[model samples]
Target: MRHLCLLVLLAASLAAADPIYVTAFRDPCRAIEVHRLVLANEPVVPLTVVVGGVERQVPAVSVALPRTDWVVHRALVDGLAPATEVTLRFPGTTERVRTLPADLARPLRIATGGDTMHKPEWLAATAKALSARDPDFVVLGGDLAYEDGKNGARVVTWIQTWVASARAPDGRLLPFVSCIGNHEVQGSYGGDITKAPYFYAMLPLGGSATHAIDIGDEVSVILLDSAHTTPIPGPQTAWLAEQLSKRAKRPSIIPIYHYPAWPTVKVSKGEKDPTGNRVSKLIREHWVPLFEAAGVRVVLENDQHTYKRTVPLKGGQPDPGGITYLGDGAWGVDVRRIFPGLTWLAKGAEVRHGYILDIHAGGRIAVTAVDETGKDFDSVDIPAR
Candidate 1:
């Protein structure tokens, strides 16, 4: 009778624990898939979560983790409505996940800023500016840090400033993607693939299985190695051609690289830096002809530390339907004269610190160039596809 009385009291006490609850996924850009429901306040029980009434286990997520930062684990559920609020519940919690509005009638107000990351404080400000705009996905068009041949530890420190310290006013982590930059190349010009260890380690975004996430596809994004470890010939070259050819049919295609084919500033070309090395050579001679032939839309170039939008040209002459090349990356760095305008440039950037980008969505494309002050320096509305 004494034991029975004790059992009854224990059962009553256990039923009173709070339901474990918190936001599961914050990324508006990630494909609608199952994501691990992590605790904002870590708990001890290794709690349980149920999506659509199917129970799933909660995994350990720690802010203290640097290498595994931004990773979701264990559970993955799919087939979700975009930009909709969904519910999730755990024994002690329940939180509402509101997906980003999937139906963005206009260009998905995306903000593109790069190079604001060389200094830690600058990244904080960059994060602040981005948090205010809350772009669909932030594009780090490279040169995020000035490691100058540093170790991964430096990356962790820099990431804390560039990524961790960043938060939306609503308390969301601004997820950004990367393209290779000159600063990322260890030698500042040429280095082996291994030298760029930290770059790939941080952003493992290349997906070979899924075309959308693949390095090159419709809406293809070709990340060039520059003259870094991977030369523009051989496999990289073959792959580049394959990607460009594929981009011909896609809605939009963009190419990103560390250097320029039509350099805004005069830098000594490497003796070994063939036309292929410059990218303009093969890209123009081999690839551009194909791009023009196929209809590749944009080629994003950097390294001049300035902003420029090259006229759409075919064989060096202005061709209205040719292709547009924008950039001369000057994100966190200072700049020279390469003006930003519809016509102020083959190269005219008298200002510094800006990011150039295209907003791709809803069968419509728009280009907007934002200066460091977060002002729209120039924009063009590309007609819907």
Candidate 2:
């Protein structure tokens, strides 16, 4: 995960001497893959990337280097040592550059939900705020941009702004992974994945526009496509079952979508789902069961404006035992209510704000709600291990 730093700082760092940069991620897929864009004025010189004493010369994303902007080149480095520093070096660049450590110890800090983006510095402010504290990575639970599929070109500015937080804290771009939200659907939520052209373009990195990215053997962060491309029961259901089944050993299995299974916020009469609540119904019927069977931790939810955290229950009651579902998304946007009586909620069940989830030395994940004023209002801990 890239820490929060200025792009200019990286450029300046390179100005002194050819700088070797490293971007890191506790990839949901277990191993962390690192990619780099090399820039040098001394013609084209061969470069070799050394990681933890291993040397491999990987190819660039494009043979032709960008004269101005940073170019993206990516590759997966499998079987990596978790909780350890990884480094990257170009021959004779003075010293090697290492990737940053994971944000948490036994667990990791991962904030989620989508559709909470809007306002003047909506994206920028949240990015700056989160960056200030230094988060390992930023995940768009959904609704990254307000663009409603008017045209592929729409949200270009928002895309540019949204991607700033995507950059590594060391100034490298971290992988900004997201699932399909209602706003991402074409025109509205009742559409298919193909209608979200701009989204497909932004996330060309792959995941079927709806796939799961694993964090480690402990956590499986599955991003569902409840929007346009895939449906829950028909095709996606089978895939979701397979993914969950295969990752049964995984301690925590969390899914992020544009819609909500049980919304804390009210739905206006005229409103229809952009991502279909029926999909959540499928998730409730076919998916949540597997989550319980698999010892899943919590599901990162969004779309409805209010704040919510469902009782971690196998059934939707005050069962002393259940999976805690977190989020109704109020990151930057305004919501309708703060929830009535969420007895099952761990915390922030009715707050209108964002939260910072810290994973400690153990697999305990802590949630602290922070308002736009950078104040902490509430906190809770959940065992992610």
Candidate 3:
């Protein structure tokens, strides 16, 4: 009789548990998936979620977060109309998710930045400002959460904060795209994927962190690992070459990564080498050539906490016909100082900001930098090639 009473109490406790964090993501910008990380109070059974009136069962998968009892459930909903709103019904919550448009004729707006979640207040302000812009999606260059790949509770808080603050003006949740940075791993550099467990669990970017996704038919955004978990040379380089080659004729092929090839701040002499030794050098040698050859017009880079835009350059010299690099992070973190006498830099500033890229139908992108106060600080116009 005692064992039966204890078992009844356990079952009742599990039945009353609710989800802690529920958010949606677009992996390839086409497939929409929802992840629900249940609260650690109790273990819950598999639950059914309704996506667009269709019921799908989501099973709970145990997440190995140190000293945490959180479990995650995933549900992928397919065959939805583009640019349309779909309703997602979890047990006690309902969220509206907007799908990316499939038509290339319509203009698209993307807001991007990195090095976020350092200070909670700054992150909330930046997220609110970006949400007010009402962008189609967001791309983070990395250093997200600042969890150091171990603090799972911090990671959970970060996600919850983002989901709460990063909503469109119309109240729809915006999808997220990201790359891995040094802070995402335990070693901070040159470590394997095992070092960044929360990143893999939270953001499912296929298997590898480096991958490419297309928005409509005109633009291709390539997200790179930046030597954090994956090396700059070897198979990643080969994959990059192939992706660029395949999209050679694409109107806009933009690469978003963590480290900058032409850094705004000065790197120590000890970090530079000729044989593609460092992250920046390896990118310049192995990736920049591919980018230049493939006619990549814009590159988004982060890590150094300052805002910077480079002059169009080819072969290390400013040229009218060359790729332009935008950004040195500064989203929700303190700004850094830029090295003086850098000829390649067209514009640089010490400010917390994010980029709003308005991609037109013909591939011309009007880039605008907006600060935490939602004020525009800088603007650049890139013509279609």
TM-score: which candidate is best? 3
Compute each candidate's TM-score over C-alphas: 0.67, 0.71, 0.88
Those runs of model 3 whose alpha carbons end farther than 4 Å from true positions after fitting are 1-29, 41-62, 270-277
What digit string (tens of lDDT, one per residue) describes model 3 on residues 1-385?
Answer: 9999889867744553433333233433446666666655545544455556776665655454555556455566566667777666666656777777766666788889998878867777788888899988788899888888888877766776787778889987777778998888999999888898888877765568987888777778899989888998999999999999998778888899998897777566665421223678889999999999998889999988899999998988999889889988888998888877777889999999899998887678899999988999999998887
Q: All models: lDDT?
A: 0.50, 0.56, 0.78
Ranking by TM-score: 3, 2, 1
What overall lDDT, based on C-alpha atoms, would model 1 receive against the true structure?
0.50
The alpha-carbon lDDT assigned to residue 345 of candidate 2 equals 56
The digit string of per-residue lDDT tens for model 2 on 1-385 reads 2444566667554543443323233353334444333333333433455556676665433322212333323445554544444444444443332233433343466655466566536666655555555555556666766676553333544544544443436654333467777676666555665576656544543536566766644555777766456666767777777888898776556677767666665544454532234556666787777777777766778877667766676766666456777777766666665555545555544434665666554345677666555566766677754
Query: How does candidate 3 score on lDDT?
Result: 0.78
> Cα lDDT for residue 307, model 2?
70
Displacement of the residue 295 alpha carbon in candidate 1, Å: 1.0
lDDT of candidate 1 over 261-362, digit per residue (tens): 655654345633222345546445545665566565566667667777777666657776656777776665666554222332454564444443444553
Rank by lDDT (best first): 3, 2, 1
Error of 1 at 236 (Å): 1.9
